[model samples]
Target: MKPAVDAIVHAFETLDPEHIDTLEALYAPNARFKDPFNDVRGWPAIAAIFRHMDVSLVQSRFVITERIVDGRQCFLTWEFHFSFKRFSVGQPQCILGGSHLVLDEGGRITLHRDYWDAAEELYEKLPLVGSLMRWLKRRANS
Candidate 1:
């Protein structure tokens, strides 16, 4: 079971979009998924999110730094690299994040929650709009 999680993590880190096909075997049919921008229900929705990621980010990769599992739950810390359509041609930027996953009786993920600082990792990576966003955040917080 642990090895299955490792394989999934590896697939994610490697940014292999083809892995989504195996998700039906790894996640429950009604799995719940949550991230900074989306709160989705069911495996199909989760699969769509992965598909969107593959299409939007060129050469996207995930690198799992840490993983801990207790019973049916696992926590993973990871770093991701990818090139956006507008950023630096083909150069990838790194984004650090983590995920908490709860497995079902069959050792398939039933719930998955991703955590990341979007402002620092994504918003700051934007071009001209990034500076303005930073300024507005600073001013608004002050």
Candidate 2:
């Protein structure tokens, strides 16, 4: 439980639209953040992405299942639990993923990259695309 990793876990665990202001202390001023759907630099851009998430999802939270740290770099495996505003209401969804983070000497994140499968975790759960995506997966596997 390094200081940087602790900060990240705490920040994500308690994150929400209102609490997003707390990110400034966790990430560097010019930090870069990237995921399957976004690639952005600087805290403002990063915060914007999170704000979009707050608006789009009905509810969302992250559970860090495992963490490995070495020097200033760390890898975390997590489960993102969420419900889409436009889709399921009471039903919850989960995406299993990992993140790679690089921190500065001050323990503020300098780079954050997330890894996850869009097809399996997202598209395959959709109403129309789900069928096609499942078919494609079956074809690929068979």
Separately for all candidates shown, the number of backbone clashes (residues 3 or more apart, or on different chains) is 1, 0
Colliding residue pairs in candidate 2: none
Q: Candidate 2: worst 10 consecutive residues by lDDT?
A: 82-91
Clashes (candidate 2): 0
Candidate 1 C-alpha lDDT tens digits along 1-142: 6876886686676557777777667788888999999999988888899899877887887889999988878999998888986666586798999999998877888889999998888888788767988998899999
Quality of model 2 by C-alpha lDDT = 0.89
TM-score of model 1 vs. true structure: 0.88
Q: What is the TM-score of each candidate against the true structure?
A: 0.88, 0.94
Writing each residue's lDDT as its tens digit, candidate 2 over 104-126 gives: 99999999999999889999877
lDDT at 17, model 1: 78
